[model samples]
Target: MDLDVFVAAHRAEWERLDQLLRRRRHLTGAETDELVTLYQRTATHLSQVQASAPDPALTSRLTTLVARARSAVVGARKSTWRDAAHFFTAGFPAACYRTRYWWVPTGIVFTLLVAVIGWWIAGNPEVQGAIAAPEEVREMTREGGAYETYYTESPAAAFSAQVWTNNAQVAAISLAFGALLGIPVVWVLLMNAVNVGVGVGLMAAAGRLDVFMGLILPHGLLELTAVFVAAGVGLRLGWTVIDPGRRTRRAALAQEGRAAIGMAIGLAAVLFVSGLIEGFVTPSGLPTWGRITIGIVAEAAFLVYVFVVGRRAYLAGETGDIVEADRAAEAPVAA
Candidate 1:
């Protein structure tokens, strides 16, 4: 038997078993004994096989071992959305303490994004023109477009609406890009920032600073901050590779993917909710104080959710209240 195959496959299985075992908050003595005994048998056999000559029948034995391991650990891959709710529980939230620190990467990506977008858009005419809207935005100039009928007559609201629309796009891109790592994340941030920079620069140069302020400050801070946070999640994913010192990329990514997705999920919720407010309120002739108040309240809610949700998930996991693990552990062992 080629015992090597058995050793390799069994060790792989043990990794899964070990993960299941350690995730427990506390293990009963009997349960711990069972785990330790299994580990010892598996480890001893693996060592002897590695140290000695191969047994001709080892292949068949190892194949059997692998099948058993697969059956034993099948429960682990079943986590679904229902699992996400418990993430808010104390068992999980307390475990994800690090997500609170995600801002570091998000800020770096946001700043770098502004620099690249600024340089690129400075020279790109079409991009610059699209942004600056040299002639009352595209719709206003086109005699039949909705802007001509809707915004041209009401320039302040139209401009404000357009600004809000563009900003919303930026925030969505930031969060969506996190799934692809920070490459697209940074791209999203930089591109939007570039558009904003050029548009603002040209408009201000044309002595339309008043027009732009009325257009921008109403929703820019909350919108832009959400985008930054989303891209930060992407950065967090990409940096996982560079910093996953002892862990394999796959293992590290699985954990990071959750937080990253959580970040994106959080970002999307903020954008959608804020977009509603910006679209309806900002362009509706609301006072600056009212706009500021809406923006502040919305931003606060977003921050609380971002910090709170992941922390809850982490703590939930740490709680050691292992329903899934317990059920899997209780499965009948076949002869």
Candidate 2:
């Protein structure tokens, strides 16, 4: 089992495998067969060397050759525009449709929480005082005040980009940290709920509920929905950790995590549209009803995308995960 002897013996085969791999796309039928045969032989050589001589340099060379030959033999999946299209049209929406129960309930509970907080603040003088000084509250709720001017303070395009980046980060955080049992996701959602509640409460107390509605509804509808989707997916990830069902915890987490990543990408696009609405339509001179109508339409379209397009995709077996070919191979386990 002399290392040099082993290397010298297998060196020609390894080099041939490398050459075939380099021209893998143009290989003839016989060359392809040779490549597969060389790959198998090289893999065997690698195993023998590791077991017998264990020379680092020879092991490394054979490992690289075997890997390249394996790739040439098996073929690799490349990302294309079609892949992107499939993700948006089928993967993302189907994921949303599949997990609607989690997110739909999340949306409902979050809305109720915001409403309750707003109601408490509007009704209780103590709560109002605790939130801000009387004059500060007045400034925020007053016509043409801080609440309305915030959208217009920066250029529309810049504002929209900034908003999109911020929301995307939040969504990413929610999805990424979901494996931590969803604590961070809940915290993120709570913080948002509080902010919205404060705005709603102050405006309602000032009898400017209509003004608040006009300002928020245009973008809030879609914007909040995206957030809800992220949170729901995140919670689902956490729940997967708790109860992996028929699958092992590792397998369940891996599947849900990949789907969550896809959801994050899709939600970013969703947030971008809402950011545009918030920056332009929310601050534009359009009538309140018009702005709100535009928001409603955007939201309705998203719902239809989820329920109609997403449902069909889900029913057809899209789980918002990558294709099987792209997924990592899992080890077999006992039942």
Candidate 3:
């Protein structure tokens, strides 16, 4: 390649790209497409100049032009608020709705298991004894005692921040380690179920079941639902590793893994709301009905968000995956 002739030939195209990028307002559709085409061609020219003819001045100039053109072609991303709005309205809800089949069953099974364990412990003094001594149980259930005091032990704001961080960490772990054949997800769910069962059982045995429910329902409903959503998405990711369907295992995992990450972020916001409720409403002087009503309304709004907005987004082609340009480049696979 004759460096001078090559530069002379492509110089016009490069200058055109520079002009398009400098425009203050939007380009017409045709001009936009032309800018992209010129950007690609100039990038190729830069590579050839670098490889076949290393002219220090020419190389630097082409490099700058290519970089600028590339940025203009790709364009700046939307504002943070816009990105957030899109995630909640489309990405987050779609992910929840798509994975509903997995999480719904998980919620049901977990509820049943906790109920059974609670009933067994409530009815059998021996079972309760194996778990904890009667005096210890009494300490927890005594009016104005441990279970009730736990929520109010810390200042509400600090308590809410702490709960949000802890719950977010749990959700992050569930999704991050989901590819480990889902064992961690299952373990987390079982651990939660056992802990809740013990509380319910101990409370019931001490004739404080109603008190336990009144305190818990205020925040527990939304908190647990967020957890279940994370666990379900994680389990789905693990299954993708085992069976990738028509796509290669790598491709399937990549798709599902990205979706799982999106869910993790969305769940962080969900858990934050629940944490506030737990720290404020749960421990507040508000009557049981008022607290529970707040919880129920929040939970219902989430359900509607998922089933209605999510389904519509899914049908409209949202997969909760990273936007195409942001995704890693993949080699074409033969059908």
TM-score of each: 0.55, 0.81, 0.78
**Candidate 3 pairs with clashing backbones:** none
Q: Give a tens-digit lDDT track for model 2, residues 227-297.
A: 99999999999999999887667678889998998898899999999999998999899999999999999
The candidate scoring highest on TM-score is 2
Report lDDT (Cα) of residue 49, candidate 3. Answer: 70
Better of 1 and 2 by lDDT: 2
- Write one digit per residue (lDDT tens) for candidate 1, span 1-335: 45456556666656644554554347666665555556445544533553354465753454344344434434336667776665544333332245446654665656566555645554565665766465654432233433213333455545555655665566556545555656877666566766566545444444454455454555555676666665555666677867755544544665566555454444555556656665665666667677667777877665565457645555445421334333212211123
Those runs of model 3 whose alpha carbons end farther than 4 Å from true positions after fitting are: 1-79, 331-335
The local distance difference test score of each candidate is 0.53, 0.89, 0.87
Q: List the candidate numbers ranked by lDDT, top first.
A: 2, 3, 1
What TM-score would candidate 1 get against the native?
A: 0.55
- TM-score head-to-head 1 vs 3, winner: 3
